[model samples]
Target chain A: MSMEGSIGQDGGSENWGPQVTRKSLMRGGLAALLVAPWTASTLGAGGGRESGGQDAEASGRTRGAGVTDDEIVLGVSAAFSGPSRGLGAELYRGATAYFNHVNANGGIEGRRITLKLYDDGYQPDPCVQNTMRLMLEDKVFLLFGYVGTPTVTRVLPILKKFQNEDIFLFFPFTGAQPQREPPYGDFAFNLRASYNQETAGLVDNLIRIGKRRIAVFYQIDAYGRSGWAGVRAALQKHGEKLAGEATYSRGEKFTGSMRKQVEILQGVSPDAVICIGAYAACAGFARDAVDLGLDVPIANLSFVGSENLLKLLTEGREDAGKYTRQLINSQVVPSYEDTSIPAVREYRELMARHDPQVPEELTREEYTPFAHSFGSLEGFLNARLLAEILRRLGPNPDRAGLEEAVFSVRDFDLGISEKVSFGPDRRQGLQSVYHTVVEEGRFVPLDDWGARFA
Target chain B: MSSASSGVRIRRLFQKTRFGIFAVFGLIVLSTSILCIYTVDTELTAEYEINIQNIAKTIADSSVGILLNRDLATLQSLVDQFLDVQGIEYIYITSESGEFLAHTFVPGIPEEILASDHGSTEPVERSLPGMGDFIEVGSPILAGVAGTAHVGMDLDVVALKIQRAIGQQVYLISVILVLGVLASIWFVNLAAKPLAELLAYAVELARDGEREDLADREILSRDDEAGHLARLFLHVARQGAGRGPAPGVGGRE
Candidate 1:
């Protein structure tokens, strides 16, 4: 396995050195040192760099921060620890696998892509600190692959605060609306569908199958609330409402009991329950709901990390099918098992080839990496779309042209069934949401929701 | 005066003086201990209440903008960090419409909080059924338009601190009382020794009428008031002895 060098925000590498270095790299190092103090002052907390103005002018080109002649360093702050670690770890693997393939094939216009990674543990404050470090200390070209809604929502303000520095967050792995709405929407380019779209599709399909009384079990944060709002709106369209609701805190582990939440939702006799939480909590809820005999269909959003959720539910269980029965998960990315899709075939091939590991320093907990997951597939597509944008930026890429380049991409095919398109009004690339169910120990796309669920 | 009776007189004086010292020191210790315990309990309880309220205010002030924007996620993050302060058991925020915006409850928002008065600006001390006592304080964000922030400080922790403080005060006061008793006993003995000896000498002289001299010269050295009085009495006694009972000789005269 070829390991790519990951530079931390402290200008240090994670045991792996960049194999691609240009003659100007030493000067770039010097320029970074001269640029650090100024960037540190301008961007106090979650601030961005202004770039070395005289240096860029001297070169007669608008050189962005974190971009040398030979490489572009992007920042990634996600949950590499805690209950959501699988999401972060797998997402990084997926993105890096694609990037590794790109770099191996003589790089993008002879410049290799590197990630300056930090662990936010799926928290907001640490995410904010990581963003500030990435922007000011590491001077990353842009922020990419931020994992959760809470972390990304907090980072949005920082992105807006440093918008003058031309810092944009690309394809965060959340379906939450904060990065999709106004005031903060312009700062992020999302590749995944919103939670509203996911919940609305779930609710709409469930309603079509006569499951009108829907209840929600959410993770009591912006992510949960976004899904809750989506469910509510979707139910209102059919002249119905949530039968009941329950919430759990973020960072709740799978071992923690969800009996109380189960009892709360069970009392209302909801026909179906939609969970908008991380894998651990959602799995716990599903386990307890089954153990307590709450016989109803349980649906989850894509953010749940469906593979990890199923793994927790079925791991060490004598009756795995009993727990996994009637479980539905909504996803923004197509199933990785569907190799008929060009991207899926490419993703599976590259994931096997690169097998990128979460940097050793970020792996605070022991996690067995999945060979292929929806999370990494989305990450692969994110990296693919970013590479396309960077390619469109031509041989000389600057942060100033990033937004225009992203917008200029119209009807771009990511080798998936859904065509990705972006414009001045549209910040999100893909708007389609797919639903799936467990079939033979894996999530397969549910072609006929009414037939299977009914 | 007979020596045996003189010794008895000194013993009686010592007993009386020691009893008086014990009584006085015992009362002082009891009163001081009560005062200290009261002071500690009152001060600690007041400080804890003030600290919790200040924390609630700080959270509310920081949450105003996030709440106004209706960013429940950031508002939750804002309130969640304050839980690290010791004794801060829970925190919750409400929107201007009196709906729950964010809270730090694990299972769910307790019905006690849901039913409690969000309109109250005053801090209310509550006994949550299973969660123990709390001094629930609220602060209005943006003059209550952005809604209210409530912080529940665990009163059990405050009570435990106060108990520890009071226990330490009692220990200190008890030690002081014991030391006071010991020093009082020694001081009383030192002060009453001369008087006790003088009384014994008088008793002897009343019984014997005369002696060659004061037996204990340390008490009759004519250096201070006790010495001068002892010497003067001895001289008068010798003179009277020389005059041989002028007023009432033998029986009644």
Candidate 2:
């Protein structure tokens, strides 16, 4: 009853005057203005904002893992013993060539760069296992140059889990969108151009020359899908798209599934066929195509492992010279013949000097072809970038510091004409793409597209 | 007195001094409420559009590779996966020449959505009675051969959300308005307190004439109706004091 009495009857009080004031009016107006933006921003989180790798209670004081007084152990989980091993092996050799030289120079601040390598066989599950072991069991300071899209996508949740500990993954080799964008990009650092960019270049060049009826042959998996998506998007940009398409199941060996794919593509009679698969699989398709009298220009994305594809097409064949000449491949790294480029020159010098056993299967002596490789060149560029960041860490190093140093690599040149840089939102550094064709059993830049193979 | 007469008196009293202030307060409350409700509505619509737009884009961007490689099972699976997402009406992929390649909706999409081309950069929006509102986004499978995709999304969820938000807004605004009106009543009473007290003291003076401390001169100088009444009473009181109040009170002294 007392509580009822305290509130009183609403109509009991006779309303009079003096309640309204200028100040109350202003306050009400201000409240309305302030609450709108507040509500919008609060709800914006459902969709906006980059995913994962945010440290809620971040401290920059602790040193990074796998770092020591005399040595820094880097983790590498690539396809060391699988279908993509040629690419993986070549990439590691390229990075090691640079690391070996740096170590011989007494290393950075008397610390040698050491690698702890794992073979993931280019599979997703194995990649996850290898990455976790490298991070949790092996305690490697950084994860670098792991190949393939399936592996990188599977490694996303692990990266997010270790976000609080400031685990910075450096440069997984696949250019899939997942590793380039949020949730996965939180800890992923990529140095190569995306499959999107590579395919765009291919579509542009093909369209530029009036090659309207284009076909695509791809591997049936994430890697194949990424390249297929890129080419599709690029073709769409010019109001064009794939004329025909065919896919081989993942792990399908060269020429094994080539007949079915060739039949589909040959039926279309396209002016050009853009191939998206590993070197062996693509090479098998090409060998089959040439034999079937489908003599159209064939272009493979950079992910096809260029040198290995040529090796696959040429080796133990009487018509090796004829088979390779019809092949065109996109390159993220420039031609290995151009000595004017500092990065290319550095790669060639490092490979020849340090990893001299690396072979060059050249058909012509037009330029210094000593250990020339697109994959190794990419690896070399990745290493040069890593060494630059490591030197910036001073004597004391930690994951947080490494992350900071990673972003601080602002517009710094590593010999590419396009300035390489990193920012808060930008995870990948290089955007420029190049195209090449095989001439005289060598990967020749596209400027010499129709050069006759001797 | 009858209840009707009492209500009449109350109405008349309210009309005299409280009407203007009530009108102003009522207007402010109504305007603020409308503003808040509209703001909430606009924000909700924006959020829905942004989310739908992003979904359309992500699907279009992601579908290219599978669509181009002619991965039928995977393409259909992707289509079904998108269709499984909440509020997705249908999704379809077509060749550059308008041939249906892969689609989630059977009997296929309507002619309107199917007519979309890769030439347009922005998503095309439409509404149908049974299908609700829809946004169709097209992405070209540019590199494979010649294919484009169109994804249709249902916007009935957005409309439902807006309706629900409006109901909440009305409820919240009604409560705030009621509380505010009550507080306004209290505020006006406080402002009128001095006038009420002056009137009561004047009544006491009339019952027992010539009280020295009854009149308040400061209130007479105020600019309100209470001040005007106070001034008139002081003038009459001065005249009475001058005329014969002292002679009447002499015997008592």
Candidate 3:
């Protein structure tokens, strides 16, 4: 299949609040706000105060990292143009949509939030360079919504280097164990449940349903290994092991890797296949499985980008192979279609209200798809959590204050299934995971699995 | 308010003793540590109760087949995995009739669990201080038959974890307090030293009716509370004896 890793899973992955502060424009520091888009070029030279030296009690706004009197600027270094473009682009859009919505509603304590992005192009090497630029050159208040495992691996060491500066990297778009584990995770906070939680739900559900001969299809990298290890652990819980396994190289494009995997998987004819890769490749494997008359269901981990993979599997047709039925994609977030959850409804309303434009190539329905994307939905969830935490920082907000505020978010409801929480020793958010099966171009919850297609 | 001046209080014999000072601050440190541990322990217990319930739910949620097929061997082995997990007391499965089918513990059901309707997967915690602190979770194994999965977790694990965390924090707090005590002791000595020197100079001047330079006492050069007291002492010594060095005793160096 020529459509390998290069193909965008975009079904995957803001604003200068005022890059430069208008010094004493109003008699009071925060009495009034300038309703203007912040440009990064004129980053205020006024916040010359030394790091952690300026106490919150010293002024109305503590000057450190990306905070100033009027607004806070958040920096991101994710692939908006390359392999993981979908995840990066959608995550940004989702967070920005919420930020814009908040700003329109008078912002946090009258200080608006701004997001600045550095395109790492889904490559780790660029991640190293781009993070430096974001940290030193851009001086974002905090880094948010980073995408990809390779990128996070490079960012962690650099994060440690600048740890003393009181900057927190919030909600990186990775479930890789490294970011969730200690030491590397000290400066990191995660919004999504880890891949381990996702795969455990997937493998456990499958095993419960009598799918004994479980196989795995994974990308050949840390991301793939994370899902693989989770599946192995979950199976071992059932006193079982993997029936078969296959792997594809990272960032490898259209390289008959799916064909080789199909050849390897068909021999064992596993009862179910748990795939961990980008949408294009995982969809290719599922498509080839269907074409080859492999009757068993081919499930994918959340990393497969549910909608992106579904679009590829269905290819614009609702009834292709009855194939969508055979596909079970585990998710870190609830399905976009299930609007009963307050967070999901808010996500749809906020997305539709704030960012109404759909890309020209997509049909209105496909672009919106029950008016949601799993990636955007997740992004929206993260933004909501971020906003709630920022609100808890009170009037004199700083990175240190923000960290304290985040830790105080105990059992805070995010309107979605998972309750967001943080502690002095706890960093990850949303321990709960959900599973979905595709039905007519939509991902329906797995608990609703048998009833719909019946 | 006890309006006795702090100077008089500090000069009191009991207050000047190391044991008295340690008792005052040490009680505060001990009380604060105990209060913090109590608060943290309560929060950890609540959080872990939910965690144990969720774990039980996850186990039952994944056991739909074993329970459906009535596979006792798989059930025992599956629940056995949790045996090695810290804090879990027992994992038991029951038939629709409330009979114990398989268990990680001995071949019996707890009288407390068997007394309730095992149909509900809802988790309940019982704090039997002498017996054991336990959270028993029950999940429906079958749709109609009402077979259930039960897991009981001991809350002592969470208490132990909190104790360890608080223990580490208390250790650090003790280190900081020790340093603070040592600093206070040095400061108390520092204040007493300059006072003693000034008083000795004042006595010598009053007795001999002669002026001596208190400025040579090093501490008088440094501006501080002691220096201010030293200057006052010199003035008092001159006033009590004579304004001009008794016309001959010494020059104002």
Candidate 4:
């Protein structure tokens, strides 16, 4: 409920304009009141529902009983309208395609999975509203593919309140620190590598390259703070303090502010630069650094991934190449650009059949497969997990029973990614990361960075 | 004819002279004022649109990098960052498959995203306010990853910025217009001074009955409209002078 936290999700900055005008401010206030009661009622109704099929549903053999004789529903929330709208849409596409394939495959347990999607716009208030709507009005059996750190963070409390009531939130897209920790973390599962793991892997790689004196350029936000903490922890293992650090507000386009930080790093003349920013800002920093004649090799977390960085450099291809060639990134998901991977092949086939219009040329880009692979893998895993829980739900199942079955899952593998196992203390259920570098505008796996973390 | 009738006619002629000069000055001032306001408004509006377009292009360029890279987290961060920018209201990203990915306020997933196959893993037409419909850039996440990254930047902010800029320009233009009106009045008076003097002399001659020298001095020298009017006035004055000349004409002797 902190305003700073809320700012990232609810278009908090949008309040400025309307607040400046009394007429619009009054209108906004009225709309909030009108929407408030509706949201409350929806949440109240969702909370009141409980099914008595717990015993039959908890046995771990139902496979697909969540969609039964009367209902077939699936739910998802993605950044439909916010900053990460592009990625949200891609993730949605991947999920939708999988659902299409499922529907085309005659569905599971003799019912079509009707996917009910809500646009949280990558903000929490709407995410909570949409989640409530999905559970109450849409009556989805479970929530799958929710995205964003602040978004997932906001809805966690509500989701936990409904946890015992049979609403299961699964496979959140963010790997924020608290999301991977205990207490606040429960019910949801994360397939992506935790920020800690990603940073640890990145630090390990930097050390392997014999690079010392690291500088961190990060967005001044939770995501950046989390990555910075991880970097600090990793650096501690080598007994080194950061050489230089600079921070910028998220979405800030100007690099002038970061120039001072770049100068500090240049003074130290670090061999590697650890940039924790979105594609544009990071690229901006890189371009700015190169402009200032600082040619350090750059490494970034999985947040930058490969596709975004390449696109960022594409504009300044010649300039970017001079510095980007030495760039490295850590990924939690399999590299889609690596066709040698079986998962990538299956994902490619799925995209072709269910969504053929997705350009075939994208396969050439390294990060294209990465996004597709992660999204497809998430869909495949969520489906597999749901199916496994359903099979355990027996002949008749309800929401509570589904939660029990899902939490009981141990050493489950969907063939595309790592085996997922969860216990009373462990809710995230997956912890692995892979390191990759951009070569010829494609992500090529360098090594299994997860093993280093372990 | 009575002496009183001639005196009354002379007074009436003086009144017409004042009215005619004022009318010419008013016409010049009004036309110039209207033209100045029109030109300034047009230029201001055009400049406002151009500024908005520039902002839009910047947003688009940044968005392209975010989308093509499939960096949702960074993209989300960018959205929050841009929220403070003068003219952006919301940002939305959709995948090539028409899957709503992330948005500013509304969750990217809606029933339409699940039901419609329009995006179908290909870059499709997506509509955004201000920017209209743009083709969502379809960047393959990886070799196997296929999806479109649809980004919507609410240009309302840009539009609003332009609006504010235009508002300021309007205030400035209003100031300029007031000055223009006053300057036009001063200029008209300065330019019409010589003509006013010529008309006064012709009126004096009509009253004084000065005839013999009036014909030569009062003839129109040029074919321009003002010159023709001058000649007509002189002819009328000469006729009046010729009819009653002897008293004032003794000076010529």
Q: Which candidate is the best by lDDT?
A: 1
DockQ of each: 0.30, 0.01, 0.01, 0.02
- Fraction of true interface contacts that also occur in model 1: 0.34
Q: Decide which is better by TM-score, 2 or 4.
A: 2
Model 2 lDDT per residue over A272-295, tens place: 888878877888889888888888
The A-chain TM-scores of all the candidates are 0.88, 0.80, 0.81, 0.74
Indicate whether candidate 3 or candidate 4 has the larger lDDT.
Answer: 3
- Residue B152 lDDT (model 2): 65
Each model's TM-score? 0.82, 0.56, 0.54, 0.52
Measured over all alpha carbons after superposition, the RMSD of each candidate to the real structure, in angstroms, is: 7.7, 23.3, 23.7, 18.0
**Candidate with the greatest TM-score versus the true structure:** 1
Query: Which TM-score value belongs to model 3?
Result: 0.54
Across A1-454, the per-residue lDDT of candidate 3 in tens digits comes to 0000111111110121223333432332322333222111121111212221122232245356666565666777765553445666567667766776776676678766655445665666566665655665456788888887757765776777668877778998878776666556788889888887888887777776778889888765556656766787789899998887777755544324466677677877788888878776787777777767776878787766677677666775656746566888778888778778897788888888766332221211222332467888877878888888888888777777777888999988889766777997788878878777765567777775334322
**Candidate 1 A-chain TM?**
0.88
Better of 1 and 3 by TM-score: 1
Once fitted onto the true fold, the runs of candidate 4 whose alpha carbons sit more than 4 angstroms away are A1-71, A252-261, A264-268, A315-320, A356-387, A447-454, B1-253
Off by over 4 Å in 2: A1-63, A255-257, A356-370, A448-454, B1-253
Distance from true position, residue B181, model 1, in Å? 4.8
DockQ of 3: 0.01
In terms of docking quality, how is candidate 4 classified?
incorrect
For model 1, name the residue pairs that clash: B1-B203, B1-B204, B1-B205, B1-B208
Report the C-alpha displacement of residue B116, candidate 1, in angstroms: 3.8
